[model samples]
Target: MEALLILGGAVVFLCAWVWLAVTSRRLPVGLFVVALALPMLTLLLRRKGYSRPARLLLLTGILISAAGVALLYREQPEQFDQLISGSWVTQPSDSALSGTLMQQPFVPNDVRWQGKHLIFAEKAGERIRRSLVVKFDRAEALLQGTAIDLLPGDTGPWPELVLQWYTGALEQPGLRRLDGGYSMSLALAAQGPGQTEMVVHLHLPSEFGTRLTGVVVIDGQPQWLGKSAAVPEPRPAPEPAPAPEPSRTWQEVSILALLDEPQMYVGQAVRLTTTSGKEFAGTLTAVTDDKRVVLALPQGANQVDFQFHPVDIQRLQARPRQ
Candidate 1:
């Protein structure tokens, strides 16, 4: 019985897609219905005792259907807007106050356009206050948001300007605040004097519903934008600084040199090997001007001090830091 339901749901989903492709008139509506239904179908299939091959086929179908819907929305956003509201027809408006700032489903409640500046505002809720602004001068492009500011020196071409802005923004402190806990991207669609076209892409969390939202702006005016694409993955954080190089104090030196510069080895761990094959490890205590030395060695319970002539020290080694 469960297998039958699983098979039935898959058939219905495919039939819906076929109906959409064949008619081409109600594509968005059919795609939306299928997108919503495909998951439920997959869920039912998983609960059933279906064979592995059968379950895999159903899951693959869900992924393909979802990808197709995403592609359609990306390539033909205007058409997708038709299904947003029965009364809300998709149309372009010159004034930001009246026309839709973005496509349906993501239509901002408020949009303000001033000379060289554009502001977008969404309906305020209890937890989130969403807004964005873009300003441009002949010498610089400024993007100020709720949490971060992208200040890039005037570089010709919008793409390069955006790229530069992105690079600099990463270095700015408190980037997570600007992102509002979501992934975002800025792209240059076109550019001109007194007018610049761009897109603000947002990949919100799954709880926010749509993962991608593209806001298209032209000449400081929003043309059309919507939440429709996958958010660009964030780059990895930088690697940590390499550890400091170890100190090199094991170099060979003459016993007379040690006597002359005993201050250099004071308080340092030193190992002295004599010509007779005896080794002594201790802290250098003192060196007399007459070429005499004092070594404090650690015995079982107490430290033993030894006095020796500089010539008795055949080899000296200084231990590095722990």
Candidate 2:
């Protein structure tokens, strides 16, 4: 989104520059674009010169030009934070939602332009260790209601029921996950915890399968949701690192911003990457006058080596935690 904004600004600046070159000396670049594009567009006016329709169209363009500039300089207000947190998920004696989304009243699966990450409600405690998807915003949400987690098994002897959940049937409230347990074709269950449920059909890797059954909560509202997932056991706590003293700490910038810098001094180390496929750690090795960057191999780096790419790369992040 920011990239698009920068690009649009550059295009406008370019038109202003070109207009300044061709127009009369008295007008500023801004005024030139506002005025020049007008006469240039006169050819589009089919009516004869000084005609009523021609004057109306020209006046209309001037009005639109003023409106456009007003919009360009306008600072829009911050967005409403629709992100849900806390008991919205876990405490549901009055409700069972522990995560976002379900914590809020279901308002018809709405339009969310900013977006979310992780099926928080479904994932609960799962960690996305070393992932390849790049997303700067780690906003999470959960689709809670009911779901069926399916697991695989062999032949009639075949597999884990946890690998299977009947959700296709819940989509329209008429679909089903067949109980006979073997057909590729699914069947609907006359059963449900509500008039509608958010069904998740888990297709496990072809090899491993585990035990499956109704996901029952020991404490909170014992929701008889379709399926359950094995909450991943938390890892043993690692030794904590010393927090940086404020005096020694440095401000951080996004990799995108670092790329916009006209130059990088030697030994200028910066952090990049985020939960998304962004670069979390890297050093700026070189920079060009055009505001493009060259990232160096990271300190003690043992993974993929940095390579040359002619196009502008947006992967390296330099955002520092405050």
Candidate 3:
């Protein structure tokens, strides 16, 4: 059916081009034929009488191609429809399937099965509820045929993967928890008879963050587990500072008066070093003007994002400058 559509459109375009070329130069409208010959197939028009064979042929070609385009459109309406994909799981496919799955209480954080949406935190899980729609742009639409509607379901358990290959970016696997300012990445997904497995990854970018990878399975009718989304790239692990050896067993020092200025001022030139002795060059912001020194880490310095003032200056000095 799709092939026919393309064939019909090609035929129509070819016919129009033939008719226009034959009538070229004789009629003013045949000038349109000249433009049509462009590699881009543009259909610019110039006023021309229909007297010339080329003009008439071009007109005939235009009509034929238009009709062909319509014919092609008629053959693939399903590709343009709202509901292109669907799935249903009457029973859980977890290896640990237990009747307790059916007995799980309807708690907000708990996943509840209701033959429709899997209600998690009172929100619909695409796998357990109505299908989600994803609409791509023109180029993507051409490749995948309009918008696609797909269902999200349990493809496997945690440490396992919950795969969703359907319609919307929002419905994509790693986005559900993004609402809570969290993100995830998927590693793998597969299914088995009476069993399914999925592997997921999660990363928290905030302070004291962690990266976790694990698999999960659902073998019962109703299973509710706090499933983390897959992390795209484990936030590059914060580089571990060199471990302190026994010889380096030293107490920390203070920086009471290391700068000429009493307190860090906005736009004040500053040179500083961390307790770990990392050097930094930056300007002070409006904040931390009192005792706190808000040092802007260099552009690409993330893990070394902030700097604070040391209460005492006994140890942080420049080692008494030669």
Candidate 4:
């Protein structure tokens, strides 16, 4: 069904292009129409089992279309941008604000304006930093009110902007570094009066790609924001830590526990190395109450019993199960 729809759309597009080429008498449009139609015709021919001719036509069409599209995009960049790009305008409601938040790719999740307060939010996750742009219709009114608060996730009350502005410079009072990202806020109250247009730039915290769900509450009503909207900066790759060396010592209680399980350890191949650089490999025989261990060492057809103090042994490990 989808393929048929695509085919039908392509056919309509080609027919329109053909009509434009014929009526306007433009050489470029005619060439572009030919380029666009060739691939479709080649596909139809291939589907009909005309393999050899289809392949030849497909190759030729692809090359022509590629060159034409590239030239068209370069010559008329604005047209290409219009075709490929889009813009999102948030619908205004009693609980939400009425304004254009961002152009297509940088669109926010939600925006609201209540009285003199303007609030907008975008989605962000852990370790990622995304930018959000907020435009105020009445900047002068907001600048005369309270501070602008920027809160990332639940950790807030951060005062991003204070009640002072000097030569377009803002006085950030509660700007601090957070564990996941930066803790900051923004306030337009410091801006000079009579300013009609105001744009606020904000960088939300990173939460390791986990969506930081929060709201930008303005005036009193909470406006929900941040739903996979913010585009975060690429974090640097983490450095791997070095592996730790294994310990050689054993606890006294652990050694005693092994002795209690004589039935499991007895006749099993065991290896013990001492701090004095002596090593022994044999089958475990007996464990004495005096903190000593006995091993039956293989000696030709005979077995020799070896005894050693547990305190002197530095490392002991069991061999592979036989």
Q: What total of clashing residue pairs does each candidate reach?
A: 4, 46, 41, 16
Candidate 1 lDDT tens digits, 194-232 = 444444434334444432234444454333322133434
Task: Kindly list the per-residue Cα lDDT of model 4 for residues 44-127, writing each as its tens digit.
Answer: 432333334434544454555555555545543433333344311322232222222121123234444544334343322111
CA lDDT, every prediction?
0.43, 0.30, 0.33, 0.39
Q: Candidate 1 lDDT (Cα, whole model)?
A: 0.43
Cand. 1 TM to true fold = 0.23
Residue range with the least summed lDDT across 10 consecutive positions in model 2 = 127-136
Global fold similarity of model 3 (TM-score): 0.22
Per-candidate TM-scores read: 0.23, 0.19, 0.22, 0.22
lDDT of 2 at 51: 34
Ranking by lDDT: 1, 4, 3, 2
Best by lDDT: 1
* Number of the candidate with higher lDDT, 1 or 3: 1
lDDT, candidate 3, at 90: 27
Alpha carbon lDDT at 255, candidate 4: 57
